[model samples]
Target chain A: MAKPTSRADSSTASAATEAVLGRGAALRGRVQGHGNVRVEGKLEGDVAIDGCFAVAQGGEVVADVQAGSLDVDGALEGDVTVSGAVVVRAGARVVGVVRGATVSVEEGASFSGRIEAEFDMPPELGGKAAR
Target chain B: MAATVIAQGITIEGDLTADDEVVVQGTLRGKLSSRDRVSIDAGALVEADVTGASLSIGGQVTGNVTASDRVDLVAGGKLVGDVKAARLTIADGASFKGNVDMDV
Candidate 1:
């Protein structure tokens, strides 16, 4: 598989920022970003970020989240669009439409959705500024 | 002192902003903001805003959550909020709902 785009310059790890959906956190809206994202709480709406998105264990989501890639381990209810890969861990449950180039779901995981995918990360992540 | 642990069966209502470690195994209703580690134990129920340097969840939450360092949603956990964190890990048995921001 091709490498994913870097969210930060190789030299500056602090150049990155992440928004969290903490355990008991909740929101009802849409989100758009130029970076990565991780969901560990609960949400209801849409998400469009330029970087990767992760749904951790114990986390739950019900929205349409779009990002470069997605690594999920929990429960999700909605539609997802991943340009790169979508990894679903064991015991995770997902229900919706999914689009990605690479899709991997571990045993014990459950999913019910649509998927379409194919794309690789760029090489020069630390080279230019994206708007 | 030790961290604040909300043992199972306990519940609170209000926002939380702490400077030390905290563990929730009960229920909360409000906002939670911390400068240290925050943990939500299994069977816990939280309904508040959450913030911390590092966060770990193994329960249920219904609010907004922000972690500066890392956020981990362990198995059997349920979350409902917008997330912001540097590192995020969602393992098996987790459920969530919200928008996420991980700027790089």
Candidate 2:
């Protein structure tokens, strides 16, 4: 068994502003905040964060997510909107409509969703871009 | 380390169920049920019903609490609700206004 005091100290030292949903835990509701959040368990609801959001391996999320950035390596099933980049790593399973400034999907990942990335077109190609 | 930690600056408004240890240092406004230990650290705010095997409160809680093992309200903790546990302790400097049921 780990000491509570030591664990608290270490967690604070590592990610003082980040929130974590550790393994073996599950939440059913809404999570909204301005700090970074990482999930390694199960979450079913709506998530709206002003900072980065990540879903680690073994994690599962079923919700509508809005964040600054998103990193996924587990299972995600929802509509995602991010102001920054969205990276779907290998071994991830995602099914949703993703909208971000940039989207990158790694090999070996299972994705069944629509990706909309907003970017400016090169001048040589077109001076203005249309959706 | 606790299996689940609601770190500072985060707010969760729903139901949380954990099979292992859970530590809350932020805000929770719903229901919390854990099979293992539950810790409410200082500066944390909880406005929900809590159930766990054991619970340690060092923050502010405004709801009913049920513990199978024990419930410890440490110094600096503030609770305004009912408590149901086999063993309970309220340390000095802790503020509490609630009913206690020891099952007897």
Candidate 3:
């Protein structure tokens, strides 16, 4: 059998600005930084990052989040403000207000929140008057 | 592999509980508890009371530490709090300013 090398390579490829909250771990506090963070466990509190933030499957986060971008594949219950896009993947459960450049909720994802996205309309669509 | 890793450039302030090993390469302020080994890597800054099965510090820690196994302060490590463990070792070049209790 060929050795599984991709897993090892990907783990080593993680940059210094990347952090992981693995499964079986729980944190009740505030995480603030200029790096990306992936949550695979339980987090309760506040998260403020200048980079992307992701919540993996089986993960749970109950806190306000401010990030460059947000991706959820688990459970998130808090307001989120992102400078980039907010993607609620399948099987994800998200609640609270979401403010981002773009917000997309895929099928199978449960989201109950108001979305605030600012985008420019095309000229053919009545432009700003369409608002 | 450690389950929880606080990577560099990140700062966490609060309580952290884990059933598995934890590795810190960032800044943490609060309490840390783990059922397994804990490692404070070089360049990390920890200002919290730490409780673990075993601990190895190569960075700067400014709180009391309690370990069921052993505690090792490697070279370049700096600790400024009390230590309670069964076995403890402070390597040369490590700076320590705390009381040690071997539980004899």
lDDT of 3 by residue, B1-104 (tens): 57898988789999999989999999999999999999999999999999999999999999999999999999999999999999999999999999999999
All candidates: DockQ: 0.04, 0.75, 0.78
Candidate 3's error at A94, in angstroms? 0.4
Interface RMSD of each: 13.6, 1.1, 1.0
Cα lDDT tens digits, model 3, A1-131, are 74669655443444444788889999999999867899999999999987789999999999999998999999999999999999999989999999999889999999898999968787697677444
lDDT of 1 by residue, B1-104 (tens): 22444434334454444556677766667667767888888887888888889889988888878898998989988888888887888897799888777756
Candidate 3 Cα misplacement greater than 4 A, ranges:
A1-17, A123-131
- TM-score for the first chain in candidate 3 comes to 0.81
| lDDT, candidate 1, at B60 | 89
lDDT of each: 0.71, 0.92, 0.92
- What value does the lDDT take at residue B60 in candidate 3? 100
**Least accurate 10 contiguous residues by lDDT in model 1 chain B:** B1-10
| DockQ agreement of candidate 1 with the native complex | 0.04
DockQ-superior candidate, 2 or 3 = 3
What's the C-alpha lDDT at position B96 in model 3? Answer: 98
* Clashing residue pairs, backbone N/CA/C < 3 A, model 3: none
The superposed Cα distance between candidate 2 and the true structure at residue A84, in angstroms, equals: 1.4
